[model samples]
Target: MAPTESQHFGVNMSSLEFARSVFGEEEDIGRSLTRGSIPGDMESVTLDSSTPWRLKDLELPPEPIMPLLIEAYFSRFHWYILLFHEPSFWNKTYKVYCQPTWRRRDLSDVVTVLIVAALGLQSVLQDSTWHGHNTFRIHHINHRQLLLDLVSEVRFHLIDLLANPRIEAVQVCTLLSCFYMFHSSPGLAWSTSGMAVRAAYALALHTKAPASQDRIAAQIRYRCWNHITVGDSFVTMIYGRPASVDAAFADLHELEHTDDLTIPPVLLDLTGFSECGDITSKVTFHQMKFRLYYIIRQALNRFRLLRPSQPNTNDDLVAISQEIKDVEASLAQWCQELPSLYNFEDWSLADRWAQLEYSLQNRPADIQEHAEVILLQAAMIQLLYDGAVILTHRPLLKYQVKPMRFSGSVIDSMQKSLDAVIGAALRISSFPVHKFEKHFVVSIVFHYLFMAGVILCIIPTSQPLTNTAQEAKAGVVRIIHASRAMAQHNRISRQTDKLLTELLKIAVQRETLAALDNTSVTGYHGDEAEPPLLDSEMSTTKDVPLEGPKELLQANTTTIYQPDLHREFSMDLPELLQSYHHTLDTGAARNELSDQSLLPSALLPLDPHSVFVSEQLDDIFGSLQSFYS
Candidate 1:
């Protein structure tokens, strides 16, 4: 028989059968072909040609407003650009915004200006309440309305801007991504960042510079490319998605060069009078950040490749673990090699907080500048380095459960890394709410805090109680408080606040039960040379009740730790640990289970062989639901 069109080098077959054979099954074929494909509705298309927001038809903000917006952008947001761009070029380009005919600027330039102005004004307003600046408040409200209108126009014209890609369009897209991030729209920020990455690649921004290009233009292009690279990696990690650009494909030679460029300092009072080394140090801070992000991206990639869903061999797990260790070592070395100017330890938490408060209350120009410098440097270095530590150690949270003997060093490292995370969170929370509003990177602070809380929860069960265990308990309470404060600015902080509170309760209950168990063992074995029950022996004991809901016990069981009797409740150590895991998996609170409010009074029978697939702590911690809120 002749082969049909759907058949491949085989006998004749029915169309449905052929389709199923070629594309797994009917459903798989449908999904593979239709996944994420745009629908036919014209209104839903972002790139519709008939959209009305043409540059000529757009309404520009008033002339007087432009200078204020420009000033705000330069004062607050320009450092992000100056991190990479030659300062002289930035100043030159910024001059165009001051001109009367700025309306005639390129469409991409207009979009860039509007986006920067929007972010800048929003940042100013977020902090204006702290400074009690009535003038800024009045201007902010009017400019906010203007910003809303401009943002809508930008969205309408974005497709047209990207239709013919240019360097300016790349800049616009990059700044737009930042705008979305600052506005607490990370998904949009991530999507816009992808657009910027693709546009930069299209413009060959990552390619080596051509000899014919002007020196300043080449420098700007290199800086822009580096910015996009770092930004893309950052957004990808924040979203827990794969990176758009690979490190191997990026031309990072310019970033590696140590030669000092005499560019105008973004913070004139801080770096204006410094030597070339100072300028290099400023550039190096960003370069180091980029390198650290690249390391994080690699760690994230390895994690994805070795996730539980995929079939994995012991060899695969070992390789991934080794790779993570390598990244951790590299990160530690990076921290040690940081320049003296970027010393993260120079500013104590108390000192920084005091400086910030004095600057805000007194409004001394020098004090304010000093505060800004401290925050800018501290936020940049501490957040990235501490975040890197968290990312590197995060894989261990899963691997710690494996059958290998628990290593004390692993626990120690976890403690130190968590401390770094908590320290960073404390430093950030000390700043006024408005200071955080300007920096989109502050969004990750919630993740850091949540991860710290998760580690604290695990530490008690994973290792024997010691001084570190005591510290872990104290750390959880501290994080709960910090998260509560941070929740004001970022909504993700609230969800973390709830989660940590719950974890803290579990830790307390577990600790109380463990302490009672120790005391009982001591008194019962008094005058005897017998050692206390091992964890294995404790697991099988029937006398002690678990420190959970009374419903977890049968009707025949008697409660020993009733508060009315003033006795201690006790449980088998291993069973208590198991109950902890069960509660985490099922979200079963002891009070809720006992009161029969959240769960049914009749408990479901447990199947020893049945598996309850709980979500990974890493996934729960990494989710941006709170950030989106």
Candidate 2:
């Protein structure tokens, strides 16, 4: 569709001229027109339709093409152009003239041309659908070339124009930032990003700019989105491949106000770019995440390293501590800040941002399963901190250095702090929390902390020498008990009350004689010195032949057997002992039965016959000793 004549005219007029027409001639149109240049007599230039349109020609004052061409022949040129030779003249002249004014007219013409060119390039990248065969590589190369030309043409002039109108600077910077970030060649994009920052700051510092500080702050925020875009680009590039997560991070940090913690959410919309499924873009997304993580990690590492040393150095330790506390506090506050819930599963740019409230505000929580990942990360960090605290407290141990000891109070405080965190994890794992299904990880963390606590409790950091046997034995006993307690607590369950079920089992077994009743029994010869017995009488009778070498079973066919074969009888031990001693001797069968009870129930049951009839007569002696000895 062709633009109407009036639309063309609107595009040609500068913002000052448009403003003049809107307010009528009585307004200060002359002053506005003077600041923005007018083409010198508008006659020396010609519209070069055969070649790519020079951006400067498009930014010229509104005038008839024929008359402007005629007047150009007589105009006196500037000394700067006179000094340059023919080749340089054309290049430098075209360059200087392209950067003219901040008015709408100056931008519209060039912007319109650039937009059309961009659309053409986009068509080529999208041309694969039309062609049925992929022509993306060819088109992609062409597209990059076109973008490079466009950026080169606009870089200088755009910066000059944006120096006073921050909003305009922000808009231009944002567009340029995207171009730079998404370009196949990001090096070119970075150059423009640098220019954009210089322009934004220049505009921001202008005392005469009409907006109040608060209003300008909003504008600055609006502009920051561009820098954020640049940051995203750097990250994506570095992460999708191991290009340089740190370098990409450096790029993000280079932008002014990148850490303001109060920029507009749109600026921080790291996920808003085109789908990065392609090879080129795939690394881009990863790099973006890597960059953000890198930034946060670097900050954290720096704070950690600096924090401890602050106390020993001339630096203000309290201030450094307060800074860290501030960041932590801000993080907690941001989490509670009502998130933008307008979009169901898709969060809006606005929803994604809450002011840094503290220093660690540039983090994102957008990937699938991020909650579990972040939870583990938080726990890992907590663990490292706990270990460090422990290391600093240990005294004269192999792992401990004499100069590395922390104060006793410091160790005590850190232990308390860790205990609280562990307690929170235990509570989280035990009860269901909304939007927190990854409680299993929390359970693991809790278990780790609990075991660590037990170890810490049992191992003395320092102790006085004492009685060798008694002290050593007491320490061993203490560790054994503590280990048992830790093991009992470490059992986690996927099912509700699974822990309680096992606890109930233990309670029941403790109170009932069911376990004792299953013990192996001993054999006795009526008031005679008994010979050994055979286990064939104690094993499952179902697996044993009923008449099984009757001598091998037990001497007496009169002996009675119960469903539980552990309890058995024998009238003749000597004959039974001779035949079965090779298979099931009973020298200490009662003791063996007692030991077998400790084997899990899932294994074989202890035989009562071995304990009752053998030397284990002690088991039954308590109840019927009068009949035995």
Q: In terms of TM-score, how similar is model 2 to the real structure?
A: 0.27
lDDT for model 1, please.
Answer: 0.52
Model 2 C-alpha lDDT per residue in residues 1-629, reported as the tens digit of each score: 01111122224555555766688858765553243323222211122122333354323322232122111211111100111122332343333334543333344234423432332342233223333123334333343454455555656456344433433454455445544444234455465555544444433321222344454344344324334433433333223222221232233222222221122343233342112111211112222333333334433334434433422421332334344444444334433431222111122234321222122344443332222232223333333233232222221111111112334443343334334433333322222121111221222233333323322212211110112211222322332333333343223222112322222222222211222322222222246664443454243122222122322233232222111122111112223224223223332323332332121122123333322212321222121222222
- The 10-residue segment of model 2 with minimum total lDDT is 74-83
Error of 2 at 12 (Å): 38
Best candidate, TM-score: 1
The residue pairs found clashing in candidate 1 are 492-626
Candidate 2 deviant stretches above 4 angstroms: 1-53, 56-105, 112-142, 156-166, 181-191, 205-322, 340-403, 407-629
Best by lDDT: 1
lDDT, each prediction: 0.52, 0.31
RMSD to the true structure for each prediction, in A, is 14.3, 27.9
